[model samples]
Target: MAKSSRKANSGAFSRRKLLQGASAGIAASLLTPSGSSWSQSAQSERGSASAQRLAAITPESLPKAWSREEIQRRWRAVRQKMKEAELDCLLVCQHHPGEMISERQDGDADIEYLTGISLPYKWVVLPIEGKVTAISTNQVKGAREEKLSQDRGIDVRIVDGPWSASIIDAMREASVAQGRIGVTDLADASRQAEGEVTYTTYDRVLKAFPQAKFQPASYLIDGVAALHSPEEIGVLEKTTQVGELGLQAMFEAARPGVVQRVVWLAMFNAMVNASGERPFSVSVRADGPGNSALNRPLEEVIRAGQVLSQECSGCVLGYGSQVNHSVVVGSPVPADWDAAAKDSLDTFEEMLAAIAPGKMVKEICAAYDRRLVARGEKPGALVIHSGGLGTLPRGGSAGAVGQIVLQAGMVFDVKPAFRLKTGGTAQFGDSVVVTENGARRLGRREMKVVKLS
Candidate 1:
């Protein structure tokens, strides 16, 4: 996350003086909104600042961008696996077939990773041994395909009307006569499935394609999820920086008599203005006691001496990074607050230390439980405390918060939190990469509670 500092206050000013001071600050090159202009000297200074910020992000430090050769190799691997599993072909849907709101479209991550196309109104049919074809809405013809397939050189077929005919035609062109065709859609089997052919989409694929087979494209999804290239890391780092800016704004807005939504709006505006991006999710909550730590920010009025927790995540180029921090308004923390924050920090450090490539997730969870027990605290049942970080495309469960084995190239948001018996809680999280030696924190700033008195 990015470092934050307080904006200097120009106090005891009359209305006229306040306006004059504002104009003077702009004229004197003391302040400039992000991406704004000033005198030539100020512009040069801002340019230097930009350069320094860019220099901090080492190009060689992040993972490599996926090459066409690499993508093709992985695709061939999946095709070979499909052949071994006796599956005819895999059908990946771009949008959800069901009209139900809960059954939304498939994640764009998997489709983009595979075809370099990241639209919701598209579909792809990757046969075991044939050309890959995409069926998309006619309106998106030329533009969407051109942008998505700029690198991979894949052509997307435009569908004028219903998707069923377009899908069937593509399947026939791939020579999928009577074999089972794997599909990502669960509701649209008859639309894509042909006579004497088994529909291999989701659970029913096995039953639909008895002679053929049904296999999920999970391995392909997992490969993309685990793989983190250099460009992706840069985007994620920027996202973390945006999150930090939001956190800082939250701290600044957390004062006595400020409504919760007002604080949220301030933080939201700060982040959007700073990065020109919106947070994936932003929530704020403040109360005295008997509240869940994950409380959503409501329209409740803020009172003096209340603890406010602000959690935010920014979406940059589709990837996201999240951070949460608690702030005190108009009062110093109680005696127990310091100890709880310290213990939370300690637990976070322990978790970070335990994170390494090749470590079993189960072992890490066990270690967390042991540490909490040693601290004379009840270890809440936490299945997974970390995960591979990236844009969540589709196929996997939405918000799949769970434990998985650590890999060398994977990035994780390692968060270890504990609730105090006194009805208060302490929490902190940071983004880290699992390297061959150990984990590295992307946000180098120290984690601490901000007490605004």
Candidate 2:
């Protein structure tokens, strides 16, 4: 992910100055604010300090993938989900780099999760009774990444000539051209907004396999992948600890006179240096003085009484865990805002307590929403959301009352950014997992507003 940017090396690198054009993650096309639906990315300025200073390339191996039996076990879980959906085979698509919300690096975890292989320009085809294949453009480019997955015992190959042609051949070889097939990125015939699959490619696939029953299978892939296995949870727990270390680094780096981006910059090496080689993603942006929620760095000099808010996460072997916080620069915290943040933390605790096997999604949502309302603060968009791959899926729609029940091993993220009586948002949260008893916190850090300066 750390390719050199020709433009970003102009002069003295000022973290705050990069805010004017720090690389923007995930354009509006891939995701709109009204809802986190798929869309495209925006044009980002090159030569940002992040691209040069905090590129997330590491040399380490924390993921000794599950054993061969375990890989088959997970594959069976995929088939079970497919059986429930009546799909004979599932075609999982990769996300455009523009679809990810990250600081500088982007990844495709859905593909990685299913095949245990993480390669770009690739597709994973999983048929009920055949070998699951990781389809890539070429063997040379992904040789290193391919070896990593091969070490874990998975089949990896390169598509000859056109990718569509290769895909058609693969399906025909498995005799699935005329059978039911599921493509995750197949947009509905109407809007058909360009996501990872362009209209031309979508039409080409349809034309190539005229009689195949192609359908959208994103829900099946996302829903089941959202639930973590025992081995997956073990990796996520390690990811959470790495995130805690990054947050701790951010806390230690925050002080009077420190640049806004310094907090984020500090996390770059601190995470990699400390964690060795766990797959991790870190993003920290300050909102005090010259910095907005969307912009990072801002070169804004930190002063007393300003708050630094951020959404930082990391993945151990591509199993993601995240945490959000708003740290105060100095004392005499605003009572109204403090109360709201405290209530946010309190509601988060309520959410963790409420998540248990067999509980309806709406039941847990309402249980926490009511607690926030009683405290005179409306619960934010998502009280709880699901975790998978490298992305955090907001479990269905936040505040959408529903009967979707929580089962053991389901993992979700909790981030509360509520309207404050004193103004602005009071944001804080962390990741958790649903076990037989209740939601267990994955992060190692304490749930309290930090006082750095």
Candidate 3:
């Protein structure tokens, strides 16, 4: 269940304050881990769980994605920010809809955050003083994408042409031919543009509208997309809950003689089918006396002396949470394996304890130092992370630039691992939402390993 754009446009807003239709391709890749982790010689993280209560409720079980009021509230907030910035229109170019797994920088999900519907590719035009509209050359599933946009009250119009022309159409529909335009590839302040709005898109848009003043608006868009509304928090909660199903599936199925891919598919399929999630991808790896290559698959086979770890995200309405855990396949546990897991688990707990509304991300990350140092260990690895609404920090903790304070509505995945004396990583993590009181655990996935029969 990947969180890429689905559904297409039927009869909606036209190019010039009228009605027309648009047309598609696959989606871009999702987030790529940056900074600290790649440099560390330690092991990586990703995985999921089982069935039971998860099947009882799902995104499909609930008909509505966001209330009309919720969408409007979001619009109003963006508009106000636009007014403050003196921007007449904000043009957003998101990746086309479809699942892809390139090693490069994946596209952003700002469009998904703004509109309930995620399209394959979009040239969304948001006006500060007029009607908000979106134009796309990428036609999604008409029945699904179109209906969702209509239901969400978004003035989305499908058009056929170059991606740049889609921007021209959306601008004209909103009657914004010339004004100050804020251009963003939907990246936050911390990272360079990774979405579809590359130099070509921007240059094309610039030539199409020479009269308009254009400026980098990532900071502005990030401002609006930064904090999570209560409704968003609730959506994340569901993703974490569903992630539990996949996590359970992984733990239950991880055993000697099991196919590694089958174990992954068990968790992957569980999240998609049971929770109605659109998972992008998951990483599963195993290590032991004879197994070592981190990214290579295990030939779909699990063995007794292996340590298996997985990193996965269960997404609900484009909101997702990560669950990372490692297990010893069977019996006579290897020396210090469980201890490494315990240390990571304890470090996660330390992060939670350090989280508060006024705390900086670095301060929250200090828990890694405290726990690791107490264990006579040092963390040269990234221990804590945060992400939501297509806004995820690459590498390190919440403060990629080192100034992010813990806000009540922020969601994060704390993956804390200790360097194993046996030459690998013992890692654990899960997604959580920050609360006024502290960090509220959204994922109920098992942190400690349990024996599987």
Runs in model 2 deviating more than 4 A are 1-61, 96-100, 103-105, 139-142, 151-153, 188-195, 276-281, 287-296, 371-380, 390-392, 395-403, 421-424
User: Each candidate: what lDDT?
Assistant: 0.52, 0.57, 0.60
* Residue pairs with backbone atoms closer than 3 Å in model 2 (clashes): 8-47, 16-298, 16-299, 27-41, 27-42, 29-39, 29-40, 30-38, 30-39, 30-40
- Global Cα RMSD, each model: 11.3, 11.4, 9.3
Q: After superposition, how far is residue 155 of candidate 3 from its true place, in Å?
A: 2.4
Identify the superior model by lDDT, candidate 2 or candidate 3: 3
Which prediction has the highest lDDT against the true structure?
3
Residue-by-residue lDDT tens digits, candidate 1, 1-453: 222121112343222233333333322232223232122332343345433453243212222233455456656766876777677887766432222211112344445556643344466778887677766675555452344454454547777775666666776677676786665533322112221122332334343334554444444444445656554455567667666656655654656776776666665555544444344446666643212323245577877666665446654543456666555565545456666667667766776787777776655555556756877866544423222122331111112222345677566565555555434455566666677888777654457655554
Q: Deviation in angstroms for 366 in model 3?
A: 1.3
Please give each candidate's TM-score: 0.67, 0.76, 0.78
Cα displacement (angstroms), candidate 2, residue 320, comes to: 1.8
Evaluation by TM-score, superior candidate among 1 and 3: 3
- Ranking the candidates on lDDT from highest down gives 3, 2, 1
Q: What total of clashing residue pairs does each candidate reach? A: 5, 10, 37
lDDT (10s digit) by residue, model 2, range 85-137: 77888876675322324421335555766765434636777887787777776
Give per-residue CA lDDT, model 3, range 1-453, as digits (tens): 112233223454312111001100110011122232121211112222223345465444532355556667778888898889899888866643222332112244667667765445365678886666666544653545556666666676677656677677777666666889887653433344454467776787788877888876766656766677877777677777766666655665566787776666666655665444455335676663211322233575876666776666666665666667766666456688877778778888887787889887777777676766777765334655455653555345333434676778878778876655544466778887888898888765445555443
